[model samples]
Target: MERTESNGPVTVPALPSLEPIRLVDRHGRRTAEPVVPSPDHDTLMALLRGMVIGRRFDRQASALARQGGLAVYPSSYGQEACQVAGALALAEQDWLFPTYRDSVALLTRGVDPIEVLTLLRGDWHSGYDPRPHRCAPQCTPLASNASHAVGLTYAARRKGEETAALVLMGDGATSEGDAHEAYNFAAVWNAPVVFLVQNNGWAISVPVEKQTRAPTLAHKAVGYGMPGYHVDGNDAAAVYAVVSRALAEARSGGGPVLIEARTYRLDPHTNSDAPQRYRRDAEVAYWRDRDPVSRLEALLRAEGAAGDADLARFADEAERVAADVRKRLAEADDPDPEDLFAHVYASIPPSLAHQRADLRDELREG
Candidate 1:
């Protein structure tokens, strides 16, 4: 046993396997371990299609922000595998709690592309209802959604439901209080939830080095008495494999899990950010080469799973998705500025009613 001597005592170091689990290498070749056989060829093709669409959607959203169609946008350019895997691993009855950067995840969950962007388009709230889709709003605050997820899972279990919840957050969220609180609650209560942390290198401009000194985010799970998975975020198949297994265990009353997907943030944190100030071109180039979409495409070609025409159809569908998003956004009815006043309270107070009436009068006069 390896031991480190402290001034007061000697402590044995843990030799847990910290290497990230990867199904595909950087060159898109399969790993030595046997592949998880559940997701067949058609599933692989579907994953590829979702990833391509996500990439296209990310690009379109960023372009929209640049062109002033959106107020702000977070581009999940290189983290599509993590997003798609988290979304797809859930059953129809399961819930998803996502962050603002998780719009791509919502899209993978069959959310309308335009509906997912409505909040970014400067709407007062997320345009879609949460109950119907079993998704929480795209939260902007760090790690707040994690707490919400735990609460939802707890409530579901109290009702004897077999449902589980998947919580998605970036590496930065791990450092927040809400994250630890949620993790503690989930572990102690044995809540049926999967916490998927997309370790995308940087949280805004703060690199992971400045975030924590932990061996890996997944190691945090050991402290809480739950299994943690360290996986290659760029490997779509790997993410799907690990997340699906975790979700199954959670649904079966196994305690919660923490999954840290090792990935990179290929673009700026948001449209308003200047990533060049904090990171170098060479670093970005390194991650760009290990792109998820490229890796999956290479895998597809290697396996002869999707030929030219099949690939072409997926591409065409991706383009249609992009076009439809643009059109829906262009044709979207402008939000009524006064609609903000209506949503704040179930029953309007007299003072607020007076204020609303005054605003209505002013708008009518103008």
Candidate 2:
């Protein structure tokens, strides 16, 4: 679509193709013709390292949940490509709005593993300070962060900052009302934001087939008057390239772009979810063969971009991260009950003050 501005007409990005853009096949072979430019060797290696670490982190977090270190965990085991690539695609100045399942993405963005898991541990409202890291709290409510992303980017644009916001959601979030509202608001206001829907084929047992009737989630972008991209979520290189391009366009006043990453959630939605009751073993096995970490590792080895020593280094780093996470989390202090009222507001309200006093008196009596 073309729109006339003060200086001639500007061409909006064309509608995305129905096929998810793929740079590499499931077997880790480069596609005959990639839909977008592939990342260079350095970027590929970086992506590989990030995915390896992310997968390790995800596994460790899950183990912690089972061992009582965390209250629960939403594993991103099969979707490391989306998590690592989404974080790497952004500039440091850009903001990231992530969902509960995106802890790996937050870790990729340099958030501390302890802080990332703090919310799941039920110790704090948010694990880390949102402003210092330019990442919002990992939102648990479906699609609510979408509107927050739009509002932040729109405000940044007004202040003449070349900042872009990337909001990550799952396939289920697309079905939420806030997601649609955010989509419409971003397009209408031309907010410098990108929405990445990690469509992992299920909304907690309800498959994508039952989610919407749209040919593809990317098609929904046309209704919002914004460009949409459909990309193979397992292909780390493709995800990074597409997201990088979308973020660039957003920062350059091209408005918001919605990306539907075709990936799969290999694990249950959370620790409490029972995949055995919802999905078949055969289906899980199929996605396991397309594991993002191994896929990128294969491509690197095939291209001679990564040697055994290099791969070993990445693996060692991953192990170290896992060990550190385990050690620190185990050593964490128990949360103080009084801390709940600490960050609630700048000044305590009358009702809360009364409650605090009552709690204090009750504790004293005990």
Candidate 3:
């Protein structure tokens, strides 16, 4: 853990910290692993690739939104490690409830890349089916997904299914009343679910300092009779280990775990907002310098696990994937307006039925 010899605010290195596991320091140094061994070359490399691909995809989505190809996109640039690590920790049969900013997690859970893009393009219902993929649609209404996750887990328990339901949301979500209610349900029933809050320090420019006065987001779990763990969201290995342990506890009927992954959002909340309106230039530069991709790359290079050629290949693959997304998105159709009314109920009510008929008539006449 090297220190920056400056009078400025000292940045904490990733190593020798128990609370927040940092296998790779921000300066591209590895922290000593006395008890747990470091992840092998292949595993670490795969995690790095996932983060790279996710960051590239997020950037591409933002660009597409700007180019009028996407309706809106919530970029998940800096939070890739948290998303990928948490989702990858789960078993294939486990359920996932993700937010709009959780593309990295969904992708890690074996979701088809193009299918997610189509959902963002407003071309489908349920994104990809949850029945087969074990991953739910991207829940947009903040902490509402927490309730759904608890319900799903309860159903699974009733069915004697050996699975856990993991739900992802932002720190801003914790302030919602729905989140609290969902926590209550999970604690009372001892449902197999893990509530993962990616504390990215800002909710569309509303900094975490203003979001809540809680000492730590993880501490909130104690009120719900669940244990909480805080992990470094920028460190993929740490994120994986923490989330994986939580998943195991949940699967073994130890109730829910609330994991607050401390990280920073390296981009604006969306393509439309200017982050500069609220945050400082120095803060942005500080986090950008500690790029998650670079940290992993340095570790890989030092271990002789990756060479220049490997890095180049990774960049090339990211570019190819981004290009294909754009090409396919251009040709994708906009979602049908009527499709929205179709999924809300088992059968349409009389009022909505009449409205649908009127909508159809208007479309035909137009």
Candidate 4:
């Protein structure tokens, strides 16, 4: 990748590096040129804790899906580094626009686990107040939230607010027309927004190879007059550093950025998916060895940044979170059928009102 001058006009790189940027290698060894300085000790510790808890939360959600606690769940298994870093990189005032697969990210942002799973539980449109948390609902339609993020950031800029937005999507999302429009609008308007594509090798059943012909998904940003970043998504430190830098630049009016995080999805796309039908066992085994949580833990121990006690504490915290998730989800009340007509509008339309009445009548008859 070509480097731009520190002084003078800002320039977008013509292309992202052919290889993904990596701070920590698979063996948890530091890279030769560790481009971005490692985050301070405390930040590093937080990243580790987030990833650890995120993995546990992911496993619990997947189990819930299998046991009927949720209607559906898109587990972020093996993508904890990307999920945690994305949430941690943002400031409290900034917004996070997440897709269905980003529950781990939402959890890291301090959203309640029960609320985070409410949509998957087939209950509410959104369980939490977006305005209060600065997080939109977990979008199910691929890439649709991209436009919403751009609109919010642009509007915030117009209001003289310093808020920025981070939009998370999968590799499959990059192909959608909405994603392209969002990219173009954000660049043209100089909106403070960032697009993060977790290139986890597969888009449900389709691999990244079929998604685009571009060298890397990050290169797509060059066409929109914005910077693109390619990072090893399995490396928590690298993901955090890159996303943190992108958010800082966007908040400073440097415009938008697109980041492609190379990672893998160890579990099926959702509980219903049969990954074995498409991918082989050997491929999954390869990525299992590069597990993000273990990789980060190794780095911590190697650097003497964390010891056995610290690791145990993180594990204990994760167990507590899992237990809490189990209890709250089990205790969650079934959604009110009437709620279907509740949040869509301030005043219900006549047609929907009639339908709501019919549903109520049917329920009463039953």
Error of 4 at 280 (Å): 1.4
- The Cα RMSD of model 1 versus the native structure comes to 4.5
The per-residue C-alpha lDDT of model 4 at residue 259 equals: 96
Clashing pairs in 1: none
Give each model's whole-structure lDDT.
0.87, 0.93, 0.82, 0.91
lDDT of 3 at 142: 87
Mark the regions of model 1 whose C-alpha exceeds 4 Å error after superposition. 1-16, 34-38, 357-366
TM-score of each: 0.92, 0.94, 0.87, 0.94
lDDT of model 1, residue 108? 88
Decoy 1 TM-score against native: 0.92
Score residue 290 of candidate 1 by CA lDDT: 93
Task: Write model 1 residue lDDT over 30-78, tens digit each, in one string.
Answer: 8887445336667777788889888889999999999999999999989
Cα RMSD to native, each candidate?
Answer: 4.5, 2.3, 8.3, 3.0
Among these predictions, the greatest lDDT belongs to: 2
Q: What lDDT does candidate 4 reach at residue 222?
A: 94
lDDT tens readout by residue for model 3, 1-366 = 334556554333222233665667786687876233456778788888888888888888888889988777888888888887777778878998999888878877878777776667777755687777788889888899999999999999899987898899999999999999999999879899999899988888778888777678887887776777777778887777778877888898888888888888888897788999999999988878877788888988987999999888888888887888877777767678898687789988999999999999999999
